[model samples]
Target: MGFGHIPFDVSHALAGGMLLMSFVLLYQRRVPGLIAALATQGGLLGLAALWQGWAQGAAGLYLTGLIALVAKAVLIPWALSTLVRRLGMHGSVQTALGIGPSMIAGVGLAALALVVALPVAAGGSALAQEDLAVALSVVLLGMLVMIARRNAIGQVVGLMSMENGLILAAVGVQGLPLLIELSTAALLLVLALVAGVFLTGIRERFDSLDVAFLEDHRGERR
Candidate 1:
């Protein structure tokens, strides 16, 4: 009657939801909207982790879900929102690549993820293999988001979204340790702090959050 007793289909569905959010992150343009999407993605990641914990009979993964929900869904987004408000960065997101090209690249990355993960996970259950593929696709898409964006906030969103994908992948593996889960959460927390400091410094120096501005400033440094 516990987590392992539940059907694998449910877990697969939850993981799919997480992947959907990753795609959502790719297309968002507004800083606030992007943060909202990230928060939603984090929430979905928590749900996925919860289901994975139950399905794999790993009690510690429940803690992982809790950390994701509290830290990523709630705290990080809240912090980012405050930063956005303070910086007055509610402007349109800047992309290094156009939207059409970015979407095309995302699709290609997803397809490649499936091709790679499926073969690697072939020895496992169908659900596990598919989950791994989905998780990998999400990770790839998150990286694409980072690459496509020229805005510092957008890049931060991409980095955090990619971390969520990594958590998804870790929870999919049965017998993953409690220490590893805690360690991952701690790492994400540090990343958020570092990103905040970095973003604030950028805003202070250039009075803009565009990464291109940083590049221009680098030339001035010499």
Candidate 2:
């Protein structure tokens, strides 16, 4: 009824894939590429949950996986793509930091995550500890993505990516209630829809999705 029943390598592989996708998100420049990377991360997250469910005999994790697949992997990405197309934002991403610098920062953040996670998870299983470390790194990287990007769509993608890390950490642990997981997923869906609507309004008003524009408008009003 625990990860002890499953091969550690399998869970590691799935979680590792999710961490790798976070790095990919850091490297992406174009809108379409960013959406694709997010979708791929969602898929990896679903697989990780599925393996965890099987390992822990938690049927709830399977449902979490399904939700992630359908909502995150398919629905959210499709919506984002449509939004990008309609808004004519099919261009390179604008970042506040260069790729090399961002990546170096990401690596430093990742190391910090490991350092923090190991001590915190000292009482937990090795698998859980590793998963938590990776999850922490993903969360930090996702935040970096949000802070580093100027595009509205890129920021939204980063927000969702951070949520993915939370889900990963939740599923990695045993005995966590399924209700919490479902609620978290539902909240994210609401967040995505709300963000999309908000972005549309912003674009219509200012004719630009750059947050800097909004700040400039506010400054002019003031």
Measured by lDDT, the strongest candidate is 2
Model 2 TM-score relative to the real fold: 0.95
Clashes of 1: 1
Estimate the TM-score for candidate 1: 0.93
lDDT of 1 by residue, 23-101 (tens): 7788777788899999998998888888777766788888888888899899999999998998887668978898788
What is the C-alpha local distance difference test score of each model?
A: 0.85, 0.90
- What would the TM-scores of all predictions be? 0.93, 0.95
Best by the TM-score measure: 2
Give the lDDT of residue 217 in candidate 1: 62
The local lDDT score (0 to 100) that residue 203 gets in candidate 1 is 86
Candidate 2: the clashing residue pairs are none
Task: Output the worst ten-in-a-row residue range by lDDT, candidate 1.
Answer: 1-10
Candidate 1 deviant stretches above 4 angstroms: 1-6, 220-222
